[model samples]
Target: ATAEKFRSISPAEFFYRNKEIAGFANPARALYQAVRELVENALDATDAHGILPNIEVSIERDSVKQYVYRISVKDNGIGIPEKYIPEAFGKVLFSSKYVLRQTRGLFGLGAKMVILYGQMTVGEPAEIISAAINSRRIYSYRIMIDVRENKPIIVSKGVWPNNTGWHGTMVKVAIEGDWSRAKQKILDYIKRTAIVTPYANIVFKTPDGEIYTYLRVTETIPPPPRETKPHPHGVDLELIKTMISETKAQRLIDFISEEFQGVGNVIAERFLTKYGFDPSKDPKTLSKEELELLVKALKEFNEFRKPRADHLSPIGAELIKIGLNSILKPEFVDAVTRKPVVYEGHSIIVEVGIAYGGSIQPSEEVVLLRYANKIPLLYDEKSDVAWKVVSENIDWSYYGIVFPAPLAILVHICGTKIPYKGVGKESIAEVPVIEKEIEEGVRQVARSLKLYLARKQKEEEMMRKAVT
Candidate 1:
């Protein structure tokens, strides 16, 4: 056999060559994905700082090049600090969203990939303008990615006067893409985003010079999620090792109580005693054998309370009703917010909404809108776990619903850790606990729709009798 040839590559180089992993498989999809990644980042930044999102997105054709467009997104959000701006936008796998909280952008590869794609096609660096919240001045930088080194190369830097007293970020990139093919998906994605996040104000200026604005329907923003300690049930050997390395507590007992949720002084001491580990010993000194034993004991222990669900920020039922009414204009609308459920030690909450009759278009199949952690899932609908639960588990016939029925089903799952089936984050895996919660939540709203339909049929029957 010939000698194998192999070489190591930086994260940037790897993704530069395999752009499909970041959802830039084709020109059309790449354009859509780039816009989505930036918009989602802007929304996340605004949400993190408790600011009502005022995001502006524009797509304009390149002056001299066909099928090339300049995409710009500006948001009134917490801007990136000046020092970290280049790395944040140019380096791959660098992100600030690693905390244990609900977030739209899971991996740090989104915005950087957009810049890299642009560099590969158009040889243009991304322009970034940012003014941190409460800062005195705004800073701008033109930067590009050095794929070989996985680093940012700043081309230019400047400062601007903050005359308007604004705080946010603006990013501009020129990329080779097919706007004609991506226009519809881009518009639909924006519309769906508006429905789900009625509190955000978004404007889109297409390449055709047409501008669309989505006004905020409510001033009330959902409560932001809070970070929480990992639950004891969720901890594995790797996590335990990480905790030991980073923990401030010197004693094993203190470490247990501080690092893991639902573990208090009493429980910690008891656990240590049961596992034959010394409570007063240094947890960092645990041998490999001892660590394995501790992990096994913890997995077997069933006395700990379930993980806290407060880390999850789910959209409530009333807001769901308002959103559906505003967007779908359905005559009858109902929603349900399920109680928190645990899946593999992760806390998850499911919210479902049903809209029937009155302006909602009838179709041969049910219209489904799926969301995870407030981010809309636009593709791979059929394979999603939420779709599976809605199609296979729910009986639409019993509720007087049939093909071409005027109905819309909305399902949103919020959690600290979403079990995504793929890197695209477009679908949820079929975890039994998650599927059951979705089915139950949908059923609750479906019952309300059924009653409304039954009453309407009765009224129609009476009207026909009176006419006779």
Candidate 2:
């Protein structure tokens, strides 16, 4: 059997073999995911820099091969530095989003996967043009991924004269896709994205010469989330050790106070006393057994205050109203922004909105629009935690909602660490605390819907009496 050829593959090689896990299972899904990943990256870049986003996406079929399509995304955001552009687009698992903040792209694999899919299917390098914000110089690169080695293979790199004074990034890739089959899904994703991120301006040119634009309703960008220290309950043994190694605090007590939230001089000293450890001992000098004991103490300690919410940037109730109003056009609309809650020591906030009557048509089932960190979750609605909470936990009939009722439910979860079910990030994982918050948020809005329906019923009764 050829001497049992077996060797460990690089991250790129593994993903190349199992592209389905990264949301490129088929041509149709691949096409949709590519657009989503790129658009999300664009949004993140702009949001991080506090700039209003202008994004343009275009898809065109190959002249010779109808199945092959050229996909291009342009964004007016903070562009990648010239040197980092190749690796940023070409290397797998390379990312700058490794901080504790609410961002759309968490794993750092989305855009790279798009490049890999394009290269695997059409054997074409990605074309990139970028200019840093406030810079007049522009840089362009033609780069492809070396899947076996997980590195960027640059085909060409050069500078271009900037005439329009634009500062942002533009990415182009050629890949095999069935746009005809993926058209509706692609459009729906973009529209839902616009609904969630009303501050963004998006324009799409489809393969069939269709132009769709979602204009920005407001220039006000939501406040960017601030990075925060890890919470005591959120850290594990491995993370504890890593923090101990990297922290600059000389004493164990100081390290705890400086590295973790909810830890101060008093709390840190108390923890040391309870654990029978020297508060003055150098944290780096702790032995393996001592570190293990510290981890245990952290897990068992209940006196620690819940994680803070400064790291979370939830979509405000007013913005949710504006977004729903622009799209759903419902007769009655109500929104709730839940207070921040802690789960596994990480602070999370959930926002819920309800729109009833008017343009919203009643359906056989509830329409739940789920979002995580302001990015719309388009697929796997049936398996999401929010879906389960709405369908299984909430009794809609008590809230004056019935089958085919003209209603829509919206839920958004923002956190330092969202519990996503898998790499695809399509559904939120069912955590008890998260479920409780979601339930409470929905109920808050459901109560408003109930009142509206009750008023409508009373009005109808009065009309009947008047006619008699």
Candidate 3:
């Protein structure tokens, strides 16, 4: 009875009172994810302004013995309104659908966990200063918690005292953790981010006063992905139960028939008929056995099709240009957008691009291997079977892909579903269907690279002959 009673309380409430319940076995991991959340926010602010975004990041170490580190990200983009400040900073598990496209933060829970983690480990706070436009007014606040009770505590609130009307948001975080490991992670994140978001100008200042800046080379931003409306093709029993429980209508059949229209009714009717349910009968009159049968039927009918256009995101060609240009310092960087490659007999659609020229060494390839869902698949080439097609099948000798040379390649893959190896979130598990297509895609990329290399070789040979 005690165990049953203890389980009765809500999980959210339990975790709310115990912030540490989220777990921070490695503060660096948490901090890495936290910085990702902030950088994404800065990008979103830029997109909102209809202008190319510029961001500056700085890291400083303080209180040497304690190793307190301050990391700040400043963006010249569209700043948030005063009304959204509380909800954006305080709340957890909030979904914003103001824009319909699929994004990394649909739950709006990305950075709040950061704030909670900071309050737990650092004993300091996260600070934010911002203004919506060119106005001299700036709203600043520090986010903390009432640690004794695990409640939110506002540490500071004010406008910028300098009176120099800055027009963007600056977020400063002070963390009491190991800065060395965190520094490497931040650098890697910026490098990867540059490859993906080539259009944005990025500047990073490290704790040692070293700076790395990537300036935008192009004005184009990829087109926004299409929005997804609720589809009725699939609804498992658990999902159906939640939907029915939250629905305004009392009768189960009534809610299924009325609340869900079009394909939803058809699916519901099919599910009910399969399980010997009577569509004409009111769901409230059903017995426990009948309800159980309904749930089983619904469970069997849960296959869904995600909208395709909703999968695409605007990846500026400039991002590729800037990344390869900086890393390889190539004399020329050329990026080609391939139409969706249809591999024979496979349902998977592979879209790929590559940059080659100047001093691109074999080790310099920064392949942004993403699944169809746009989640990062951060696996090394050796583990991923896909690399086999690129390394073995392609002509590497001419491309300078010798023992330890650097190569710069960015590959993005998308489809209805991307099968991953495991929860470790490493490589894509090989499926016969997708593998064949990916092989073909790699062949095409290899052919392009080979042709470009051939041209360069011929030109160099001709020049040498002329000099002789």
Candidate 4:
């Protein structure tokens, strides 16, 4: 091939072409992701009302043409207003939900992407019907997202004549794809969703006519945690450069001190000391070359491991209590603490909590899933060092460890960033120090359990001996 053929395509075409990458392998998987996005949106809506939500999903096989099916997910959530309907279902489709806290949908592209996938596979537009509580009517629209053209085409729009009040969003998509390959993952997603969102009731109907429903016996849903801002130590060279460029500060030291909240004079001095640069020195006097050297030194300082306590924002004790109580139904709550513990030479923290003496198996007594930030890492055991350590340390014989058992040990890891092994969010690369910290923490908790068991055994033996 000629050298000219090896050149990269124009950025415009590259972006447009790559946008369709979500469809190549299995369009069913993409549909699944889309369904999750819409469901998450619905959940967020109801969550805003501080009410536990009821989300319903239905799959129907349209046998008019083989391999054609319609999937619909409806929720009792706050419906979109008339003015924002077009934006919700059409252009500006990305990131309908935006917050600093860890959430499922950031790009707001989930529901929109579903429409795109539907159009691509079936060559037909998807249907949307939504209504607000205050509105007297429901609005229905048939919409198609033209990815090839980068525009949303409106096929039809009408008002649903419903005198009875209603508030919810219903999206129906017709797509040409087989459902067999996507069955297991859909089931697992529902299961995990049900497990984590213990208060949200979910119902699903498969294409095969199998009906599955997850009902919450409790009325409590974990409130969305507070948002976390970017700490000064976590920002890299590019961020620092951006800060310098956008900031209107007359002096560099003032910019560093005022714009960045955490970097005080002492921390700034420590950072500058390594590069033999003094923070007290005036930034205006420095040339471009000197500024470059300062930026490089700051980047190196950012790489140094900060204390885990200084950086981590773990899920609070109250939220964990809400989750544990809903799942385990614990009667006598003992203790819950999300503390940092040292493992090896590295700085890693393990969020370990206990809900002991429950009416359940000790082995399967609690839930333990490691999280980097607040995202769930659901995957293989080998990659889950937290799982490995807990399994190794806990005495399973006493509790009769079993799958789908009652009681769970909820353990998570919060680092500046978590390293994943592959595309799967479940498998994570093990940091030796972090793993050591986690294992040691598990062992310590296990030791407490062991001591409690020993003491009980001794007391029982003494009573029996005295009676005999």
Candidate 5:
């Protein structure tokens, strides 16, 4: 047992030591993160299934410990199966979000991180009650994560008779938190989420005995995103090698067509022939050099169609407008949903909404509401690609957005894979394609704002003339 140590740390253990990576840097952020993780998880579950979301969140201050609070979130969504209840909520990276589809969770460690944080701070297991869709019986369990082992240790289990015939999931945990510091962020997160998710009816009860309820403003819910095959352009040498090994097709031509989207038999054969590759050759038999050469050729060949955006589900323009007007009661509002485009093989769609005047408070600088995959990113605004486009690229006066005004711009970027600057998921990388799309989206709504401002000025001038 010398100072030097060698070990294989599991994913859960890595998170245990590096809790800050999940935005639990302090008591304040940890508390906000707990609420965020739970709320986002609820949104993912319900939205994926096209179920209108009914979410409830409560944080109560513990009398025994001023800084410790009981945090709970209950949602009407598809519940986890009985067997997966423990690991799904206790393990760090054991969930269904790691695929070629859109979901609110940035990483597989959703509610599990909350459970781990609670376990470390309050030494309490998370209490979970769940009933899967179409199931009759309800299951209840108290589970804790063994961070070192990277698994769940179930403390207790029971069954609740389903006499009422309702189904969903409820999670409760007691954790140390700085409520005074985290309250504003938590409230803003909820409000922003409501603005984007207009179909969800959310009721939030604060520790201060205040209740903020956001009622559902629209019945429209975007269709569920479809799981898609990877595109050829989205891969590199290692991915090609892995695909070659896993592919059932023995021939290189068949393998290419079968494994990758937008690649067909004719295109695969043409690519193979152009690269001087044997179409009949087994891809698995290719050496490292051959594979590298093949990947180089794949990139060079330009006939492959762009990746289909079927896997991306974006909140439509109408829904975004409804959500913004309902929440902000803005005097003017306009929203635009951009068609999806490929970026690094992932589908990226940008939606921008602008709300002006009315109930919105005037600000010295432009208020930016940024979202990635339906999750509100309240921190690190300057680092996000959207902010860069708005702050640096656009001329605000041209769009009639001379600030010290009640103006807020909302940017929502939906992608199969988001280029986040950090693991915190607070900021997006300034990828060229993302920047272009964001700029275009903002301009689309900004023009509408300019028109509204022009009309308002005309009306004000007319009123002045009549008064004189």
Candidate 6:
């Protein structure tokens, strides 16, 4: 390999050449991750509009192709608009998720990567059916990616009037997959997603003629996360430059106050005076060096209020308990939602739930179910910070928890930015603040379980005394 071999490739082409980074490594994992990405997109669509989600997913072997499976997911949520549908599904890194919000998908490349995989493996175009909310027309397209150009090649397009007044999105793709290797994980992902989102009705059909349904237990869903400006902390110089270039505000003082969260005009004025910058100077006039210095000052000023964490929505504690009860059917269940905490200027909330006894079959250790932004983490358990907290920071004996008992613990972290270890988004890195919050939340719910167990023990002893 030499410098002469280097050539610039489009993002789509790069990911197509190296699909494993997007979780499309092998036949087994590819099938599993395809379902995960599609379902995550489905939920995000519904959650954005507070729509009661009704989703249907199915995977089956394609009739003529060996080891090729057809994957289809349909959701009754707000549909993709007509104009952006091509790029949204066909191009790489083109998505609505590149904003400040609590969403299941952080990287915008996942779904399109799945589409790219399908195109390369099976030589098939993606089938899309969508009816956006704004118009009374529905759209259908058979499209594929021109990876070298990062553009969508529309094989065919169809549009018709919406007679049923339905609005949602459905995407179908056929790809080479091994359904047997990851069957259990596929099922577990769906079930855990249902547990976390009690308001979503999920019906999943496996390739082996099995059907599982998770109906909506509650009609309520969490309010959509507000789209606020970025916090001043942990911001880089490039983003500041972009904000300055795009901002409509004329004065530097107004730019600073308007662009960042919690930095009012008064603070901006004081910050400008302290930093020896002209407050009335045009924001767009700042040089790269000056912008760098401004960012440093913002981080060190220490007078900015905490990021507005209330704008982020967490799966409430009541819904947590209800979802766990409905799924685990345990004898005792409790959940705790901790107050919001900031990590690298991103607001995060950790919610923990514990289910003990009854139908929960335990093993040598606690069964840890981890989630981030409501998407279940099915792989990489031990490396996750949630696992680290449960195994090391928490003392199970102190909470009356014993081995070989019916027990399960749930840890969910909702935030504007999830500290994922990789593009897989399967595990969280151990930030001190996040780990502490998880440990504290777990202990709170563990205390409730311990009290319940202690009372149960006392009742058993009293019954024995009466018998004597």
TM-score of each: 0.97, 0.96, 0.69, 0.67, 0.96, 0.98
Candidate 2 local lDDT, 1-468, one digit each (tens): 568878999999989999998889999999999998999899988975688899999999998999899999999999988778988988898887878878889887988999999998999899999998766789999999998899999999989777788899999998889998899889988887887778889999999999999898987778888889999998888999888888899988899889999988998888889889999999898888988888889988887878999767787888888788888888988899999998788899999998888898889888888999988888899999999988999999999777978878899999978898888889998999889999999999999888888999999999999999
Query: Tell me, what's the RMSD of every candidate?
Result: 1.4, 1.6, 6.3, 6.2, 1.7, 1.3
Q: lDDT tens digits, residues 123-201, model 4?
A: 6777888887777889988887655445567898899665777887888887665678677767766765664566778
Best by lDDT: 6
Q: What is the clash count for each candidate, in the order shown? A: 0, 0, 14, 13, 0, 0
Residues 348-429, model 5: lDDT tens digits: 8999999999999999878899999988999988888888888889999887777688989999999888898767789998
Q: How many backbone clashes does candidate 6 have?
A: 0
lDDT of 2 at 37: 93
Off by over 4 Å in 3: 1-31, 64-66, 95-100, 132-137, 146-151, 159-167, 231-306, 316-323, 331-351, 364-403, 413-440, 459-468
Among residues 3 or more apart in sequence or in different chains, the pairs in candidate 6 whose N, CA or C atoms overlap within 3 Å are none
Candidate 6's C-alpha runs over 4 A off are: 1-3
In model 2, the runs with Cα more than 4 Å from the true position are: 1-3, 163-165, 463-468
Candidate 2 local lDDT, residue 447: 93
What Cα-based lDDT does every candidate model obtain? 0.89, 0.89, 0.58, 0.60, 0.89, 0.91
**Model 6 agreement with the true structure over 122-234: per-residue lDDT tens digits:** 98899999998766999998999999999999999999999988999999999889988989889999989999899989999998889999999999898888787888885
Better of 1 and 4 by lDDT: 1
Reference-based TM-score, model 2: 0.96
lDDT score, candidate 6, position 331:
100
Best candidate per TM-score, number? 6
Candidates 4 and 6, the one with greater TM-score: 6
For candidate 5, what's the RMSD?
A: 1.7
Could you tell me how far off, in angstroms, the CA of residue 59 lies in candidate 2 after the best superposition?
Answer: 1.4
- Evaluate candidate 6 by giving its C-alpha RMSD to the native, one decimal: 1.3
